[model samples]
Target chain A: MINNQFLVFVKKEFAHVLRDRKTLLVLFGLPVMQILIFGFALTNEVKNASIVVLDQAKDHQSQRLIGRIGASRYFDIEGAVDDEEAIEQNLRSGKVKMALVIPSGFSYDLAHRNKAGLRIIADASDPNTANTLSNYLSSIIMDEQAELNANVPVPYTIIPEMRMLYNPQLKGVHNFVPGVMALVLMLVCVMMTAISIVREKETGTMEILLVSPFKPLLVILSKAVPYLLLSLVNVGTILLLSVFVLDLPVNGSILLLLAESTMFIITCLSIGLFISVKAQSQQTAMLISLMGMMLPTILFSGFMFPIENMPKPLQAITNIVPSRWYYIIVKSIMIKGLGFQAIWKETAILAGMAVFLTLVSLKNFKIRLE
Target chain B: METVIKTHELTKRYGDFIAANAISLEVYKGEIFGFLGANGAGKTTAMRMLCGLSTPSSGSAEIAGYDIYRQTEQVKKNIGYMSQKFSLYEDLTVMENIRFFGGIYGLGSKDIRLKGQALIKQLGLESEEKKLVGSLPLGWKQKLAFSVAILHSPKIVFLDEPTGGVDPLTRRQFWDLIYEAADRGITIFVTTHYMDEAEYCGRLSIMVDGNVKALDTPSALKEQYHATSMDDVFYELARGAKRSE
Candidate 1:
């Protein structure tokens, strides 16, 4: 009999979710939109950045270097500049992101001194692009140098070989897919569940529910079940987008990834329950969910900002943010393609949070209308 | 008369303020017990306590032979509640609302179907059964809410200003439903601001400053206060109330 009641309750919750157009849009549309935006539009990888070249050497080596820079996808040689003043003018006007200066030493220096000098002046106004462009130029020059000395044996020289393990091409989508999954699931689970529960309070239906013979714990559980299912759907949507649309493959076990995602979803639902219990109105619940959960998930998840770079206290604060752990677990399973052994600690933390939050919220959930 | 609700020294305190002070009362089965009070005279608080929707600070009460504190679930099973705010899901269709509520109350599917059909027919809402309750007129919504409240045939129904914003005609029709329910042995415990509606009760309790100042039949209270109507008697008791909403 109780099972029948629970089914009926869950059915009603689904009806509530399906009947509201705005909620339907939010439940499905938001995840898809976020995935497309993060995967394609808001990428960190710099491409086709225009630069001005100052080739004073007017020699074969200098022209070849310029040709390599132009041929590479990272940069576009907008046009040649006569002097430093023209380079400065192009950079100041934001026409070019970088200025490549090959000093007049030409091929003569490399033949005599076995070394060549090159200068790169990048617009530092946007520091990330400046740093990345300079690094790309340095690597290209080093590649040319290595090729030139390929035939001649240089004695007693140690050359370090660097390889990026997971993402060879350094695709931005690989990093952001996990972050977006964490963000979308957190927002959909926490905000939607909190608002749905608090909406009952606002419309005064919670009083009727409280007075009914149904258990208060069941009341909370039934409210969360639909959102839990919906969040899983969201996870699928994100993964599908990442694999097919973003062309980022899932490296680890699909079942394990889903299991970890379910754990995180439960954690978010528990937080939503906590917010619903404490909030008197839907507006308050929404504000608290957005400000409290969303901000921390975005900032502390270490997907957008590296946790190591943050101050010590801020890093400590990130420890309690469930998404921070979820983010790490997702990257491990999805990007790094690791097994459970690699992510057991993060999984344990997420499970602990889910248990702790569920207990606390259920304890705080008032059986009375108070 | 069987006492379905009995309370003694029931109090609810919020730190320094007492929302419902120590009070004592008994309500007989099938009585239209009018719980009258001023704006903040604790009418809703007392009713909430009786319905097991609020815990009392220090109190002992028996609702349908179940302890209010220990067997709250039993107390809930025996009572129906409708608040001043419209508590039905406005987004749900009328039939859907009936089925949902009936299901939660542990009613059988057959019983829900029968009750839902009879309710829709009785309310003349057969055509609007599939329409969202949000589109219904206020009077129809109130009537529907009341009918849904008693669908399980509980021992008592606690209505906290159930007819607050309806017109007089709708309110009268609403009272008719109450009378019909009372005739069927469902005790009606209602709080209202309408003095005219107060006269419809079988017995009345007038609360002033969290205390039941008078408890008697309407005419008897009028005679004792030497007043012409329930309105004057209510004013005589509630005029000095220091609390205002």
Candidate 2:
């Protein structure tokens, strides 16, 4: 039987959330807007980069290579330069992002020695773009070489048959949509809950609630229920945006995703409760939730950075963040089409974190106002 | 008269410092008991202990005939508490606050609605019942908070400096509400810095240095201290407190 007191507390919580239009807007609007922005506006793909080629050879092979590079959508061949100074000037002036240098007798070297020398000079100022651009140019040249020698019998041609599975198109949106979903849900749930609960303290309403007939645990639960429901709606919004707007399909069971989302939402709500109980003011709660939870979730959780590529200490730190496990679970479920069996470990981790956080918050929550 | 609140050597200690020393007092039904003290005189600490918001370091107390320590739930049910700060949800409407507190106190929905409407009409907030509590003036908020605190009609209402800051007119009006509640047979246990307001109590206990320096009717305390007013009486009693050391 449902306690009427608990239901009334929940209703009051819902009324507080609905009455605050600004916080409500952020609760619902932030996830969809972040998904759309991170999906459509942001990308890591090499696309339409301007480059100048310095062909010292000026041979048919160099011209053919240039034509192939120009044909590829990843790069635009500004023009074929004759000297290194022109290429350097083009790169230094920011006119082109990369310069390809083909040495003299390039075709003769390929015919006699079955090899040729080429150099790709890129702007190292932006290292990520530089690395990606260099890889694209090298891959394009490799493809050209493979085509030219398709009919010929060579001693050895180590063709790397790179097959990008799951997201074959290598769409950046696929890599980021789930992450944005996790970050949005975590931020909203944790920050909103923390701030709202501390708001009661700041306004002195928390003392009244504590002195009421309802238990302190029930007070925290009522505060959490509203945010938990709002976060679920946020999950739906993010998923809808991901599937419809970004064209990212859910390859796994929708129910599993929802169930996992609910678990993750609880985990985040527990964190918010812990933060609120520790914080005395709303501003302190907001600060702790953002700097303590949100930043770490985004950075160490592999939402924006790969945990494997992080330094050893940072990788160790990522293990402590709940979002890392939740992010992996979401990626496995949404992208890899994995079932509960494949994601059980991560699901267990999230569930354990939820329990631990809830217990810690419950243990720390004092019924008295001391 | 039946004893509504009774305490024996109620004390609260924080580590080595004794915030509230061994103090004993009793409040009868329908009496306006004023607890007077200077800053850090342990008025709030003693009040918090009696309200079941804090555990005593040593002693026993009962509220509404229920033991404060063992019967905390029963004690909470029989009392209402209002602190100095604004306690209503600023974002919630006036009616919403009423319903929320009413519901939490286990009032049926029909009773809550009827009482909420009656409260709104009584406060002359009929037109502004839907308005957020934050938009109301300070005076209006204080009165509304007092009304909501007593919405459940408990045996006693503990007010911690309920009229700390407001205009003279509003402070006078707030006292009127307090008197009205007291007249309705609810024990009014209040703490205030306003000496003039202290005179309104049927009996007053002025605390100094974590001890009850004086407890008597306003006139009796004035005569005993040979002072012209309660303010002079308080100053004379608290002027030599060891806390200033």
Top of the candidates by TM-score: 1
Highest DockQ, which number?
1
Task: Please write out the lDDT profile of model 2 over residues A122-237, one tens digit for every residue.
Answer: 86555445655766887888888888888777622323232222223443333576788789888989998999888888888888987888888788888888888888888888
* Candidate 1 similarity to native, TM-score: 0.81
Where model 1 places Cα greater than 4 Å from the true spot, the runs are: A42-174, A367-370
Model 1 per-residue lDDT tens digits across residues A265-335:
99999999989989989999999999999999988988778787799999999999999999989999887
Question: iRMS of each prediction in angstroms?
Answer: 1.3, 2.0
What digit string (tens of lDDT, one per residue) describes model 2 on residues B1-245?
89999999998999998989888999999999999999899998999898877889899998999998888889999999999897998888898899889989999989999989888887899989989899999999999999999999999999999987798889998999999999999999999999999899999999998998889899999999999999999999999887743
Q: How far is B244's C-alpha from truth in model 2 (Å)?
A: 5.7
**What's the CA RMSD for each of the models?**
8.2, 8.6
**Clash pairs (backbone) in predicted model 2:** none
Best by lDDT: 1
lDDT of 1 by residue, B1-245 (tens): 89999999999988998988887999999999999999899998898888877789997999988999888889888999899999899999999999999999999999999999998998899999999999999999999999999999999999999999989999999999999999999999999999999999999999888888999999999999999999999999998898888
